[model samples]
Target: MSQISKVVLKDVDGNVLHPQTDAGIVSVNDAAGSPSNVQSEIQALREKQSEMANIDFFVNKGDVNSDADLPAQDYKNGWAYY
Candidate 1:
């Protein structure tokens, strides 16, 4: 079953600018008024997380020679090597 949610937005003066409900809960915030922004933020966060997940810090060099040879010694620094 689907739920309903109520969302309200008030300015500094406590005046309601936007009042809305969806599903079974209510979200009150500036982004709540425009859920697209929230979705975009979520997507951006997910992308950032994915990017961070693929990061390899222990590698000596970014380039690998035939997978058997170790990276050059010059690539020792964590950031510099990666």
Candidate 2:
């Protein structure tokens, strides 16, 4: 079996995040945390966050057949169309 090189990662404050070993006894692999893996993770998170940012809970409930910009109707019953 091939041995993977392991190291402890630290934050900006020098606090240890990941260690060379998982439980101080069992071996832990950090190969999945390569730069390319990190970049892809960041990209996936950004895309998911972007989709989350577009969640207009109010405007999303409007009917597709209406001009959703009526000015003075109380929309408590349903969507007001212009």
Candidate 3:
């Protein structure tokens, strides 16, 4: 098993934002003028963490059937010379 590391971040107010987990803590901060962006980033990170925790099965290219053909007329065949 791989060892997990802990990460911590504190704002000027001295609040502990992240805590250590079984794997470790990953901390990120917002830029000077973008608190909303930071919140969005944190939300995305939580989603990814949830996905990792609940992952059951994974499929690789080898598992796909190769007999499938590309759809016809999906795009133009020629490009402009310009």
Candidate 4:
């Protein structure tokens, strides 16, 4: 396993806010916070991931210059016209 040598806390002006300190008993594999809190966040994102991925939206080619600029509607018609 890899080890973190140092962690620097810096400010907006690139000034050292706190002195370097050893990371005591830190686990890289452990959850950031409480298990329940992490699980809830993961579940919420998983539920929305599929719904967001399957969203249907229109594809704007450009402004219609003339009658020929518009696409033919006789083919398979949907939000995406390409």
Q: What total of clashing residue pairs does each candidate reach?
A: 10, 0, 0, 0
lDDT of 3 by residue, 3-24 (tens): 3444466678988765533223
**Ten residues in a row with the worst lDDT in model 3?**
73-82
Candidate 3: lDDT of 73? 41
RMSD of 4: 10.3
Predicted candidate 1 versus true structure: per-residue lDDT over 1-82, tens digit per residue: 3223344668899988766534223322333465443334454567789999998766344544466555445544664322
Provide the overall lDDT of each model, using Cα atoms, as 2-decimal numbers.
Answer: 0.51, 0.50, 0.48, 0.52
Off by over 4 Å in 2: 1-8, 11-36, 59-82
Q: Please identify model 4 stretches exceeding 4 Å from their true place.
A: 1-36, 59-67, 70-81
lDDT for 27 (candidate 4): 29
TM-score of each: 0.36, 0.28, 0.26, 0.32
TM-score of 2: 0.28
Tens-digit per-residue lDDT, 1-82, candidate 4: 3233455657999998777643432223324554343334444566788788897655545456654466565434443423
Q: How would the candidate models be sorted by TM-score, starting from the highest?
A: 1, 4, 2, 3
What's the residue-level lDDT of 70 in candidate 2? Answer: 46
Best model per TM-score: 1
Native-vs-model 2 lDDT?
0.50
How much is the lDDT of residue 23 in candidate 4?
40
For residue 48, model 4's alpha carbon misses the true position, in angstroms, by 0.7
Judging by lDDT, tell me the better candidate of 3 and 4: 4
